[model samples]
Target: MDKKIKVGIVSYRNTRPLIYGLQHTALSNDIELIEDIPARLADKLKTGEIDLGLVPVAVIPQLGEYHIIGDYCIGTEGEVASVCLFSEVPLNEITRVYLDYQSRSSVALLQWLMRESWGIFPEIIQAEDESYREEIKGTTAGLVIGDRALEQRLISTYIYDLGAEWRAITGLPFVFAAWVSTKSLPASFVQRFNEANAAGIPRIDEIVAANPFPVYDLRKYYTLNLSYQLDERKRKGLELFLSYLKKDNEQPVEA
Candidate 1:
């Protein structure tokens, strides 16, 4: 490697564990970490601003070539509290939906669920920014993701967990984001990267202490709600979701 690897990391609480490992270990010396929302991070990766990114799986189809260069991912087996649809009324009753601009995977998953599980086609609006959060009212609901979604848990009357919905529909774990690169990285670098990530998985207390989120139980959120391993089941879940994205509007298919 001629230069330090520039890695795009998501600026969300869910990614703190991985960040902890990078900052605490020698990996920090080898890479430059640029933190931002998932959507922007994907953009950086696309524009060659970064060598690798913890980008949304939804961005996979858009990339001409990609290397999912990790043994870890931001995944969940069931009920991921952070990625949700917030509504005052029942999901089916809502006539309009706002997709979070900061997200890619959550919005895509919600769209898939609307077509398949819910069997309703609400007006989908892509939110421009944080100002759109205030528009979540009446028949106009919104899909919120990451830390903001966690904060929203306090105010939202009706919350629909996308992870839980996907589980009920497909009976598999869902992966939101993974470490990906357009170029093939050396095996030696990949090894250290995995080790660095693994080192942070056990440091829950350290992570929370470093970056406190008093709005929710950060510890439980890290330990249970988010799964880091990109195992066989999660791989299948990722593939299944991507398959749905590849198809068009056809009144949904049976899972």
Candidate 2:
């Protein structure tokens, strides 16, 4: 028998729509699904722990050569409520910030926003675990992501949505992640994969209702905040982000 293709995906609420019907379809027979945090997904893909992953866009530049397999992605048209920096004070007053260990793309986005957009330099501490969450007070802020970030919305005094910040920096939409593989996958499998992903978007209401989120409104999140299609403008945004990841773009970029 032929070996099943190993596929990795993020264990976050935002990723639901793109993978709605994957397990129920016959595609499940040919693919082995694995779930992990976004940062870990990047690591796994790099080490060949899995064949392909719905990983952060930040990892693409490091892969040397990678294939983005699907037509859909985890992106935001304007404000993304889930990926945020929570603080008690304003951006300028933040003396230190705890960067979440979940998604490297978010961490890089925060760094870029601080350097290019916000222009506030703070002591960046890598948060190894959820222990850093409680430390967010006074001048110390914490960057929380995924489902935990959604919960932070209620109590956090000041929330800086990085997606909104990116939208402000460039008028284009931001793609947080997409389906990427270390090597080119078969065209037939890729087509079926994307079809299963596409089947999920229109059934957003059904998906959310079936799996209710405790913290935030999943309905509004899927329809209003999150954008799935990797259209031309989002591709432009992705290209710009990859360019910024290069060492040369650090010296005062326009976009």
Candidate 2 lDDT, 80-185, residue by residue in tens:
9999999999999999999998878999899989988888999999999889999999999999989999999998899999999999989889999989999988
Q: Give the per-residue lDDT of model 1 (tens digit) for 147-205.
A: 99999999889999999999998999999999999989999999999999998998999
Best by lDDT: 1
For every candidate, C-alpha RMSD to the true structure in Å: 3.0, 3.0
Q: Model 1: C-alpha RMSD to truth?
A: 3.0
TM-score of 1: 0.96
lDDT values for all models: 0.91, 0.90
For candidate 1, list the clashing residue pairs, or say none.
Answer: none
Q: Provide the global lDDT of candidate 1 against the true structure.
A: 0.91
At residue 125, candidate 1 shows an lDDT of: 92
